[model samples]
Target: MKYSIRKLALAGVALTLVAAACGDDGGSSTKAGGTTTVATSTGSGTGSSTTVKNTASDTGVTETTIKVAIHGADLSGLVKAGAIKGVPEDASVGNSRRIQYYLDQWNAAGGINGRKFESVQITWDPADPKSYQTSCQKIIDAKVFMVLSAGGGFPPDSTPCITVDGKTQYMGIDAVSAKQFKDQLGNFIGLAPPGSASAKAGMEILAKDATLKTAKVAVLRSDWDFANEAFTEVDKVAKAAGINFVYSDAIKVANLPTADANKNVALTVEKVKASGATSVISMLNFTNFTVFPTEATKAGLTLKYNILEISSGMCTSFSAGQLPPEMNGASCVTHWNNFRLDNTGAKATDTPFEAQCRKDFEATYAAVDSVGKGYPAITKTNPGVPYPGFKDGTGTQLDMDQSYYECNIMNVVKAGITGAGGNLTKKTFQEAIYKVGLFDVAGIAGGKGSLSANKLWLASNVQQVAVTVNPDGFKAGKDANGLYQGKCLSPLACFRTVPNTVTPLTFTLS
Candidate 1:
């Protein structure tokens, strides 16, 4: 079994049709980058034990292969035209290369349970939503076991034949978030560290600083669904510490002209200033956030603290540049991880770990015989259009984006394979994944693994925050391994290392 070049997919056990069995209840969304859970939703079983055939002759060894798909993100044509940088249309080589690197590693390691890993890279236009179904049909044609991180399945006009067997799943690099997916459909788990998690983490950070805790905050966002829920938690935590939460709004825009969008941003700046807001938590995408700080600076607003979510910072298109000195020192949160580089600092480091993954990713790419093959330096910023800097450091530094997230996917897949106890087929691997705490892919391809699954012990296994900028004088874009130890302008100038991190807050819906 070999990997497919056209689809950018690895091989899997041949697919077979199975009658629907039983499934779980409606999907759930949580605060953290939402983690999705997939369950069998075939037959209706109520508290009855369903029989899982362990015998190979439950009739033929019904081979199963899980097919994972990633459609290149759709950005405005301007992005490809070099009017803007950082979109799938003109992504940096390092970005897709990292992802391909990991996929190759999976295949070389004998794939999942000796079943080769298969992936597909589809390019589509968002104007045509029907593309989602067309791509889905292709996977169905292949009779793949399941879809991973896939969207643009077919033309938006018709979502036909999206289901594969009784189990069909979909996810993507950054767009199809865990919470958003669960909100739209049922029975598929999306794992993008939920918005709730980021919101809460960001809030806890602000709460740690007394200067920030006492200042008023305006929870601003374009979408209230997840942002509101996240800020609700932030408000709750801030109130517990007696912080003054001044004002918040959905920033309703019926027909936002460029000026109107800028005005809305100005409104936020004015509101924050009027209310004496020391910190602003804007749950905005890069496109919208691009307007915020500019307006705030124009209004001569001085924020004591500020935090932008993943979109504003990680994604290159809308996050960077043009902010005034007030924000030159602000911090942003993201699920995208940069490959760990230097561990050297005033404190401890993970340089060794970073080196290992970098080596593996590089080696994996070299071994692959493909047209897109190329060596990517760990420091080479993600390949998006125009090629933006990772974050503002003394100079440009290497950072991860979709590439890093996908790399982690590769890591987890290896973990899942190892968890299978050397049983890598799609059919047998599920048992190892669902049951084992961590999947260890130790024996395959002679890579290390005594490697256990990095599965978050609980849903709260949210990735911690790192500072990209510091008014206190720390550099931005370096792998911030020290938490908040570098030279910062002020305590608040540096990132507030949130409490309860070593001990994650338990998620209890009370």
Candidate 2:
């Protein structure tokens, strides 16, 4: 059954996004004698005068300003040298820039519930696990109202930790991570693929496809604790769906550049073939994904693979014709529509919502050059063309996801403030979030946003897609040139949602 938060809440259960027996301990409060500055609106609406206040008692929230922090890999430097993998470096940098854009726009449009939004920037090395802890600690010290750790996929700072209380605490690590983060930091939100549920969704798709219905399936994912947890949950659902799970192996590889990376890929492929598995479910990065088929081809092995498409990690690479032909019919489990370059026609018939979204995308894309070269395809060629590049443009699903993540958080912040009314404390703000449950953000991948009362996460809504090779070559979907033509971008694909529901707390924690 699809777990509905409204149903549960209506039933009188006080469950939070993270089901815990503990109460908020105010662990994120500022240290004694430490002071933080907050921005607030002195008046109301767009013309309201903004004011800043520095006080010891008030950590993040103030009369005029609400302070937050964003932690992620040093994308600004990485994208400039063309060193980042998976999504384009421009997209990575664009994600951060998009966050800033959202804040500025919100302030311009009267700000969040009359108070402006501000953020502390902390860019850590992606490969350094300690950086995450240090960054979160910094946010805690700063007493930001919320923390958005916008790593490409998964929190770079999250890992299993033994708390001072001697309990096994997972902060931003797994299902319990959000709670742990909230316990240590203030309010927090993140965008991570519901891997196991998505895997089950993919299995349902396979069950319907004649070619893969009875194929011997193998599960391949990173050997991280979180990935393992996802694999375990998926294994249960796949078995329930009558999937022939012939093999399961976790790839214990890091996303860094190392000699063992290629070796690990070769070894993983060997394991898959030796198990006689005909199909694979991969929950790894795009770089590792490309390595899988490449190694398979070199070994003369034939196989089909399905991968998780989230965080703009897989779509851009795939849509850019980066995959091999042998993997033509490979499937992807995604919650959002993949982005395609569009240059069709310019029309104003789109709903105000869409035009606004596209406008936001343009604003962010235009500013990409402010940090560095921006996207090589976009700004480097035709400058100031709203949608730049080969008209490859900036309004793809990847860009939208960044906007969605931040905007949704902003929505929560606004809702919390409005709900709190005259008394907007951290506790009241949280209460406001729960009171204003099931928010539908204007433009998400699925067109509808689902949030639970009091929960800081979105319910899993996944769909499966099979790569439809385009013999006519990938065409940039026509941008608004007066009329829009064609459906879906080049490298055509077909998708069907799996008739499945993942209940909250459904995945096993152990």
Candidate 3:
């Protein structure tokens, strides 16, 4: 069982990485960033039931409800088990609730094509390999039309499978061997491409800054699927941007914080030092990102610049000041900007669109909280669902990322349904998604979200990248323990588009 769990984690990590890379878009035409008034799509449906909307399609569809599922980790359980600390129990569950909030709003306005959205939460601890199969089986048994967002990685091999009319179908959103499984699993649609856009942004930073570009650069990453793709993408950009890599190495992704893990990071740092590398581009998971940089700083290695790709978990670590001082000047490529960190006063925007998005987000958070706390019946439709404490969220990093994902899910479903015209089915949904071109997410994450034709990735044109600096005078909010958190010293700068190759553009950040 232990060995199987390990194997599943590796596979799960691979698929997650695949989604991140796909988000890279690999296209070159530059589109200016910011919000533009885009039209919304409308759908038609006939429903009688309060929950399920009866659609012509019978699979995972009814007269009133469109059945979907969200599969991921139970963060509340993790907190209780002592597996995690200092993070909100609501981190994952709150994300799920946000989905419900959006659905409730949609239902109030009129559901997609007259069919209300209903989602089942399937959660398990990632540590328990058996839990993967268990949770997946539950999703399969429920016969959901699709699985939207996965809060954490799961082993691909343990995914539940079912058959209808003698045809086999696999339970969803497969990132493992994405291209290989794409045709086979017609129902799978990726939520977001995390690493690809960041890779582009980080490389651009290196290229545009002369003092940093001339200095020796090193690349460090874990031996995982996304890390490999990140390194390759970064290396390609570096070579083209006239920046050269002085040293590079891959370390094992598992068994972290152990002696071997410590040794591996320490060794990687030594290689960076030996090669006279003054800057480092780290493409690693949260553990490796925190561990490697901390070790580098402890070794007394002063770096001119450091760029990192960190997940929401690491964002918590950064807020907690667990990251080394070497990261003080570093820039992170992540999903959303921290309002607390925006020194350019983007939070005080004058645009109605921007203001409305912000207002809606705050309202959504409130709605989700009320629903979680058993306040409004509309919010608490999922009675038995777990709702984590609201005090844990800061509306900066993880919460923002989760909200953006919910927006993505809503956008895609609307587009797919509208494109379906009169009928909604697994086949039509997939086809509509493929045909989705130039989708605008109504200023989500302070940028326009889009999906290109036939692509499984969602791109955020002109997204914001936060810069790390001294946490003085820029405090926004508090953590669960009420510790003051620091903000990014830079404004949420805009980019017209993220290209596959590096393109240097000067960004003025005081």
Candidate 4:
């Protein structure tokens, strides 16, 4: 099962959307060593004011300011380059979507004890570990009531809260997957995917695979933050299952762009082969996923493959039809299944929840750039359509938009708040975080008594492995791969499952 902070918040989403201009905080606090400047309020609703304090111990002085950390995606940058709609690069979809989803649901359902919930976003550098601590310290300094999906793994930080030993509800992102992060998981009503989500699922997936069960396996992962949690879980699972948990000799690739970087995959395969393993399990950057597939193909060695049993490391690339040929048979599993509108039965069953979810997500995303030609599609030349793009000038082109990786973490946060078993509120959200952990997030009937797995908050549950090959295409039937009739994205006319072909077709049918 996939697990991260299960995050789903950004900035104060509870703030009422006011058409009247909300002015900036003109006053500044000078009590602390540095001046505390209050951020201007953007909404005109009856917004409440809270004092955020700075760490007296860190600065040896008390500052007056509630620092709510937030990520600022320069969406305009991508829009200008015709990459995306003019939505703010860092908008609700990043984190606020979760907060808004929850708050809207709560408000509609009768909020926490009838009180509205508030949220904020804080972005940190995935490369800079200090920012992680700093963001947490800022929250502590602000003396806020609690933290939310304040952090993530792909981004490498989870909810950083004040020492639970000190405060009660220091809650934020629920699950703590990384072993190293376990130290950070003190006392906060937890809201993570299951604590054992990745480790258990990764192992189970590998073990169940008949072709890979007895095969020697190599685990490749980052030595850093969130991704390491899934990597570690997969490693632990692989070891427990008696699979060759080869890593010492396996390559330790970094997210760097260097000449030596290209060699990492060959070295990894060499280590795997040296260990006499037939397969390799990689838990590395999504960006680096191309490494092993390309390198293994070059090495003329192809075997069973499994990657991303933890976080969505390079998994999107797979579904995007971008995995290299070597990964043709490899599988990457996640708890959240891609909700395809084409699945009529599933659409009928989960349509309401999924629709509301998709609607909430898109609306929140559009909130930032409601009038831009970013989403909903925008273009005069409808090369493949009558409408050109989804956005028909009203906002962004949201039409033609198909399924991508849905950060179910948002759903987790939403579930936590809803399942708190109490009314919605900041405090209730904190409780909701833990409630999510204790209860099944998916709320599917006859779901319990299974292996150790957790659910997202919305009562939605899915675990699917996606395999997508990239630019070039190939074919392998069960006759070739045994129990695996692999298909490739081919544009070439080669109907035979020969070796490799370029311009591969989009799909193959028996």
Top candidate (lDDT):
3
Write model 3 residue lDDT over 1-510, tens digit each, in one string.
121244334444211111111122122222222111223434445433222223335346554567777765665654565444444655556556655666788789877666677878877654454565566556656666666564434433333232221112233322222322333344444433334444655666557768656888887776655446556667777888888788877886443323345467667777788898988776654434556766777788877645444222323222323454556656544433322224332232224444444445456655534323333323211101112222223343223312234455556766776565334555555677667655654323334444433444443432324334333422344434222343322111111112222222121111
Against the reference, the lDDT scores of all candidates come to 0.40, 0.46, 0.47, 0.38
Q: Write the per-residue lDDT of candidate 2 for residues 292-403, one digit (tens) a residue.
A: 7778877777788777542234543233244556666576666543232222311113235444554655556554453335443223211111111322323332222113
Model 3: weakest 10-residue lDDT segment is 14-23
Please, what is the TM-score per model? 0.59, 0.67, 0.64, 0.55
Worst 10-residue lDDT window for candidate 2 reads: 164-173
Candidate numbers sorted by TM-score from highest down = 2, 3, 1, 4
Candidate 4 lDDT, tens digit per residue, 8-74? 1232112211111111212233233222122345598555543323222111112221112232222
The most accurate candidate by TM-score is 2
How many backbone clashes does every candidate have?
58, 22, 12, 51
Error of 2 at 412 (Å): 3.2
